[model samples]
Target chain A: MVPINEMKSKCRFAIILGVTLAIGNFFRVPYAFSEPIVFIANDSVPMDSITRKELKDIYTGKTKLWGNGDKIVLTFLKQTDVYAYFLRNYVNKTPTQFVNYWRNMVFMGKATFIPKSIKEEDKLMEYISSTKGAIGYISSNKLIKGIKVIAVK
Target chain B: MKKNRMIINVVFSILFIYSAEVDAYSSDTVINGFITQGYMKTDENNFLTDTEEGSFEFNEMGIKFSSAISNNLSIGIQFFARDIGDLGNDDITVDWAFADYLFYNWAGIRIGKIKIPHGFYNESRDNGIARTFIFLPQSVYSDPWRDSLLTIKGAGFYGYLYGLSYQLQIGIMDAQTDGGLAKKFNDITKSSIESIQPETAIIFSLQSTDLIDGLKIGGSVSKWDWKMDLTIQDMPAKSDDEALLWAISIEYAKNAFLFSAEYSIFDVETPIDLYVSPTAAPYRLPYATNNVMEGYYGSISYRMTDWFEIGVYHSIFYSNKKDRSGKDNVKYYNWKDYYSWSKDTCLTFRFDLNQNWIFKLEGHYNDGFYNGYITDNIDKDGNEDVEQYWYLFAAKLMYAF
Candidate 1:
């Protein structure tokens, strides 16, 4: 019993609402959306910034010692958006490739330890803050106090 | 065989206890293991087993433990067992045990039984989970010669220099000829060969990883001297020979695609006097003076999805590079038509059932017969006769953690 014009407008509104809901569902997954990754280090470390190549070398166990001859401690977040971003950009490798590389390194006696994988952001931040020569990454917005930010050059 | 089974049981028991102990001590300790069971069959010839009627003799299992004893020192050991047709025979053996000391990033030393770094895939050859194919390219990594090339009992110096990673190993290997090589020699000379032992061996390899992202180019060279004692027509004979092996490899991986290629040559030289019969008129056996084996293969793989992958490769091997046509050797030795080379084209499919399990199916179209001894493809009249062209199908299930 509705007018033809009103029915057409209601139909249009329903279609728009359906499309909006679909888009919302698509973006609801946080990992589907890209986010910037920020590298953090212990405050005791003198270094402020690291080049992309150096960062790659560090994560791959190529550069094991810091400039001051302290053993470099590596930590990582377990399969987060920031971890994926770091692996893709800084390491220039996919997550699977990075995992395989580390496994090979460990089994071949090229490395002694894989980077410590932390699931909680608070634990990662605390580990970075307490350990000397430690390096890790988190989302840019999750930067915490007591840890120094390392600018990626 | 019972003794071998007993040894396997004991080894597994020890491994379980050790794994538990290590787990209790530190969570950092990693205990990784893999088990793969495979089936293979050929149309006419017995390719890697008595596979004329589909064989299930191909199996591999391994366990390893790695622990960091100190900040800069770590120790690792692996126990492995394999039964590939009749080659491995279900014998449990210590694959590798090493202690590594890292003085610096540019310098490290590994002491103990160390895995030899040969071609690009030799180090991880046994780990089916890490490779695209159930069987690696047999051209460069011949199944018959695995024990000789698997590991060395000595120390190796591995480090990075000027952006180049290098490893040098000087060791002595006790190469056993209880496998196909012995059978081949016995078939040729009507003799029983006990073993072939290497007095000395050296291996050197170098790789460059910084030149390109996800690209690795490397080369390796190995030299060894071996001595063998055999009975020819119930008479004892001794011989010594020197072998030289070298290979070049290139691999590139980008996103979901991977490409790899390797070429290798193996050369053996023996004194003509060693082949001569002391009591006979002629001083030399009917064997070629210089024996050269060469091969190359190229492969490409694509990951269609997170759980599925497909790959194909073409591998060619020549038992004697100088006689590519295989006519000269056949005429001289009165062997089969395709005895001097093998051309293998293979297709493979891999399914990642889960994070810890994998299943693989592979098909191969092969032309020529270089592995008749390993496959036991001898005719009833005790002659080397096999089909020139054949097909092989293989399936493997693997689990790793």
Candidate 2:
């Protein structure tokens, strides 16, 4: 007979693996748009590249300030396919879960929440250009003149 | 003491204003608010309210004002009102008012009245639009103790580590003498408890945020001293003791599905020694027992469509960890076995009517009566038996911006 402790450990690992596999299979749908989106930041932002983890931190309201202590303003997107794709690929949350996260942050003294229901690419670019330390995701084709694109590592 | 608290709050408000004046700010003011109304009915138990008659006394409303003063500073305040059973009665009160200053990406300090981050959902439990269920699992999130567990009138600090986040708080619990906690204790000891006072508590929380995508593992521990004053018969009695609670939590989300689980332990010393019966045979206290409570729950939800979702959770609670059955109570006071534990299974359906409106309906199958539920029917019928099985139905509608 297998040892009880070893068997329990193996069982735990199997459950984890099964759940991961299920998530992978369930999220295998193709992106709604063929062209990938790019992250755009304010021109005054000092950093031109960000790690995946850092991007997640900014979007989730964990990293409230930049390296030089400038406040970071987040851009909220309309509930569209692009928003869903960004939440899944970058933030690693479902759309509803992400919205819940935002609501929690807002209720817990995150005073800077200004939800921009901007679906037009021009409006997003304008908001990013006007607001310092602002970051958002837009289609590569919509990367306008005022905003600077940050490469994701 | 009340005057001192008022002065302290006013001082904090002044400090927030001075900080804003000294710092160069982007100057953006935002106003946000929400309202929720609910209907509930229970088949057997009163459930802390008169829900047996399909009561519509469950409702809450809140309005908040917040502003970012500068790159490193922000201030916010909220006014909240609610009517649950006989509690609150739509009394407008300040929910949370605080000033937070960020020193670095890994360090920040917050002062003034702030929400206590308990379990996974305590901080946002009042935000109905953010939750999928009409009621969070009662095993972990007891509504009767909300007055004591909601917020603190002190300060704390928070930060992020390598792949985890941590928060440490040192604060005194808001001492509401006429809260539901006093009522529950009164019922427990067969006395009229007037006040429940809590010592300055220390709460520490740690959670893994980046270890796995869409997965979070967390733990929290809180310790505090407690004192209560009660009147049994025509005599006044009081006792001071200590209390401690801790919990471990795990949550995961992928695609349109979410799964969460939590386990908690609450250890509290009882003050029943003061409640001696004057007319009993030995003229002694009935139940002189310390309570080591245990609770746990597991839940899952699936978003079937953009506007429709369904969820389920099963919760278990025991009033005493050592005596899972009420054999001690039966030997001491003859209370039934089911008085020591409760098991609840719930199914909920949620509909997002629009961006600002949501509606939810839920049903519960409850076994046992230890979940702060009281029944007067048994007394009216002059029976010794209590309902061992019962059901509850709840519906809620909310609008938020």
In order, how many clashes per candidate? 1, 0
**Superposed Cα deviation of residue B202, candidate 1 (Å):** 1.2
TM-score, per-candidate, Cα-based = 0.86, 0.86
CAPRI grade of model 1: incorrect
TM-score of 2: 0.86
Question: In order, what DockQ does each candidate have?
Answer: 0.08, 0.23
Candidate 1 Cα deviation (angstroms), residue B199: 1.6
Q: lDDT by residue for model 2 over B206-227, one digit each (tens)?
A: 8887577778999988886777
Candidate 1 regions exceeding 4 Å error are: A1-33, A43-46, A67-70, A107-114, B2-29, B179-191, B271-282, B372-375, B379-385
Off by over 4 Å in 2: A1-34, A77-79, A94-97, A111-114, B1-27, B272-289, B375-385
lDDT values, one for every candidate: 0.75, 0.74
**lDDT accuracy of residue B222 in candidate 2:** 84
Evaluated at residue B310, the lDDT of candidate 1 is: 71
Q: What digit string (tens of lDDT, one per residue) describes model 1 on residues B1-401?
A: 67886787776677666655654223266776667789998887887678898989998878777877765688888788888776778877788889988777778889898888889888887676657798788899887677778888988998875568889998887466776556555644456776677787899999887577778899999998877777666566666778899999998977666889999998977432333456765355547557789999888776654466677777889888988878777776666657788877777888777656789999887777785563376688876558877889999998664
Displacement of residue A42 (Cα, Å) in model 2 is 1.1
